[model samples]
Target chain A: MSLASLTKDWAATSYGFLDASAKRELRRKMLKAIAVPGCQMPYASREVPMARGWGTGGLQVTLTLVNPASTVKVIDQGADDGVNAASIRRFISRVSGAAETWDTLSASIVQSRHRVPEEVMREDQILVLQVPNPEPLRGVEPNMSIARQMHADADYGKLWLTLYEQIVRKGRIMQGAAYPSMVNGRHVMTPSPIPRWDVPKLNMAKHLTFLSAGREKRLFAVPPFTRVEPLVFSDRPYQVEEHAHLTCRRSGLSGYFMNEIPQDNGGSTFEVSDSNLGIKAIQKAEGAPTEIGETWYRDGEYSA
Target chain B: MLTVAPPDAIELRCNSTFQALMWALSRPGDARVMPEAGLAGIAETLVDLECTVFADTPDLREAVSASGALVTGDVSRADHVFLSSLENAADQIVQLRCGSPLYPDDGATLIVAARHAGQRLRLSGPGIEEPTEISLDAPPAFWAMRAMLCAYPEGFDCFFVDAGSVIGIPRSTKVEVL
Candidate 1:
């Protein structure tokens, strides 16, 4: 290898494509998130190789925090190899030689979609959620400025009235997925579009839960041991509707919130939301279903 | 240390691969099958990806080597670098790009021809309603460099190809994990 040739090769190497100025600002936002403790901070969102609502926020958080020593785990609903999750896995491995794992237990950082894992997350574990739509009042009021004011003054009478009106009109809350909740009794944040069943599970916890919306460029957090109460009234109390017919055949459990399976026929059919995935744990003690049900379409009916 | 574009900088060339991935993961257990022919039906099957790796490049030179193998070119502009010192470019692959932390979904991918592409840690994340499928080799840690990446979005994303089959994990995704 000639000296001249070596010099020429060095000149061609572009170490990083990301602009230096942009990186600095994002780092500042990240630092603010860590310093305030459970505060939602605005940062410059990047257009990743991936799109918005597709774990882009989580990808940004992971990328910003990535060090040579970290182990990465990406999960959507639980299984790691889902297309979105898998694609993220591919990108991280490319930028760095950091290790990857399917096991959520050992994972230092876990990026999730709708459902948080069934297992209890630790205080040290970091949970990054890719929020499709972050505003709780978006569906109710469709105005961002009003919702911000409502949170600022702790005015949630309207949300209560909306739910109360639903009961008075439809006999129940009738909300399917992406049920809303208040974080720290202040920020009325949307906990992604998860099933109503999982909403109860989000009580005070130890882990650091982050919500990121790449398209909206919004980032928020829920720190450890904070109050997370689902707003409900004394009479109605917030009941999570059930799957009328479908149940986890493997686990022999029924009435879980169910997503639908689009049959060849025009109209779709409904099935268990946590279907085959939830069955894995209790199934062995019970047994694997001689049958499995397929369900869901991307970005549909979470907040409705 | 990488610089980012203006929050709305020069429009970023979208990563077609990521869009295609959102589709795949959004509807788990369903394979968005693609054509095997090299760059043949890429447009039809690859609704969100680009075929930019044409033969007309200044530094790229793909050829068969004496070791009856291949090598990933100097790992620079090649963000999604693929490596397999064992096979010809025409033959099967052993490793590919997967993004790492700071860019987990941006690392190189690997397609080790291991006998099995299903084993190791379990994973789960968004874009999955139920248990999605995975095609990985046994004891992902056995790959040493591969297993260590489990921390996330900070490690390399990978796909294991064996016996004409493939399984993927992007940087933002989580493995089913035990």
Candidate 2:
């Protein structure tokens, strides 16, 4: 073949900020990640404008997936207005000519750091989580090669022992976020630093979730209707944060995950962690038309 | 303001093609429409210089080779395999790579052209909300060989294409001949 047949017309930059080769590599890895639900697939995490640890993994995945028709949303700790979230959202839209939305319901693809939306994600929508650490066994096993062997053997005893020690020392399970969860009965994965309250949203849920860690250079998936069981002893049941009774100081909504603000008086007030959900609640209260989708939690209880 | 390059036609086509493949593989047993009919788009979307691909057709092999991926004659050595028809390649089925437990990503992806209308099969796995049944035109030997070759967490993923419609069956899925 001649050079003309082999080469394309030169462009200033590749679409979505990633070269075609990078996207193809990611596409291959992503397919494998979905094939084995909750199993981390190693990828060449390509460089972006952002830092490696600061949501670059999620950004790459979004860039690979986004198109002009895609409605994109990015969130940092459940707030779309956060600088990190806002910038990522803008960059995606600017590069791809995609529509941007803070409302989870309006988004076709939701990329976030440390939170799933308060609204239930539909089967059609995709959720990409910015994972700081994709490996659930990293805490117990430092050597990655051996850890992969353990994963191959399906030997999760060390993970269980970590939980057991937590109970013995703290009188309860003290591990907060990035809880180790068993996915599809075979693989255990870190659900990406999301709070215990938000973990159940991924269990047998309608939406497909991709968890990617750029620094780690690995990505994994939790497909729709897959089992995501948090590791817990039968004697001590898995417990979520006790935030059901706390009300959001801004919107007066209760029974959802909250962010606590400590006061000078030594008491603390709580606000809804999902900022967009709180905004919608306030708008509805003011008689503005709004639609709040069904949440995983109902009245502070993990009902779904 | 920083000016960004708009997506060229190739980028847009590959992006949409990948989206279809992703959703198709994510939700097995359900049919997803591809940007174009046939497996060429898939090769362009996924296979690159880093990959070793095996294709039954010379046209597809040439297309894959043009992408800079190594064209392998052996199915076992291929990370991606494209077959014009599964019924014609029964002997090649067992040779497909089913990656070991330590690294399941080494498992190959098989894209075969098959009719959507034929013998019914039941699928249940990560993607299926409940047990869903669909029909495919795969031969019985194909099913028997697939079941024998695949071991959970260590099996090749397959995509059945019919014209513009595609259905993915990951190794995680259990296919029961009905």
Q: Using lDDT as the measure, which candidate wins?
A: 2
Highest TM-score, which number? 2
Fnat values, one per model, are 0.00, 0.88
Off by over 4 Å in 2: none
Model 1 root mean square deviation, Cα atoms: 18.6
lDDT (10s digit) by residue, model 2, range B129-172: 88999999998788888888888899999999999899999999
| Per-candidate DockQ vs. reference | 0.02, 0.85
A1-304 per-residue lDDT for model 1 (tens digits)? 3456323222221112233334433443442332222234566787777767688777887765444345778777655767888878767655644568665666777777887654556655777787888767776777766766565455777777887788899988876566767764445667777667666555556566677788877676654444556777777676655454465444544444555556687866554444334554465556654323222221221121
Q: What is the lDDT of residue A27 in candidate 1?
A: 40
Candidate 1 CAPRI-style tier: incorrect
On a 0 to 1 TM-score scale, where does candidate 2 land against the true structure?
A: 0.99
